[model samples]
Target: MISGLGALDALSGPQRFGGATGPLAAAQPSVSASDFSSAVAEAANRTIHTLSQAESVSMTALEGGNVQARDVVDAVMSAEQTLQAAISIRDKIVTAYLEVSRMAI
Candidate 1:
């Protein structure tokens, strides 16, 4: 089974927690239970942000006449697929939590 914090860290990266790295240094975060909630929230937020950006890009391309309509459609579809994956993971987590909760002590 995947650990909660590991999943969250996979989602949030280093920006969610207070951390610093020089311009040349990349942020490296170690996943822990402490970082789980923040990471998952960050992931969900990022997904939404990505979807919004994809929409904006599609719109701009439409207005500027710089790209074919098919490109925009492809971007939107990609964003949708990403969000669906996130949602599916979330549902599985909730189901696992409930199962654990129901276990007899």
Candidate 2:
């Protein structure tokens, strides 16, 4: 259900789009290593939060609470998606690290 651009924005922000306003405009925000690290941390926090929410919902449902089946399904699906995204990012990071390590000094 998520769009490609939405996923990209969620992970890297709007910086990848050049942050331009018009065709002739060329101003872009300066990104530092800390900014990238913060973004990654934020993403991890969000994923953890989502997974926790999904776990709570599932527990509530199992306890015969008032939670609707549809809501539980939605939560599970969202958690699955977040997990998949995190796994994909981890794989990419590992691959990049391995590639960099294999380079000649």
Best by lDDT: 2
Best by TM-score: 2
- Estimate, for each residue in 15-88, the C-alpha lDDT of model 1 and write its tens digit: 54445445533544444566677667776777777688678878889689687788888778767876777878
Model 2, span 25-83: residue lDDT tens: 33554555676677677778778888899999999999999999999999998888988
Model 2 segments beyond 4 Å from truth?
1-30
Query: Cα deviation in Å at residue 88, candidate 1?
Result: 0.5
Native-to-model Cα distance after best TM-score fit, residue 104 in candidate 2, in Å: 1.4
Model 1: lDDT equals 0.67
Compared with the true structure, all predictions reach lDDT values of: 0.67, 0.73
Worst 10 residues of 2 by lDDT: 2-11
Candidate 2 lands at a TM-score of: 0.74
- The residue-level lDDT of candidate 2 at 93 comes to 85
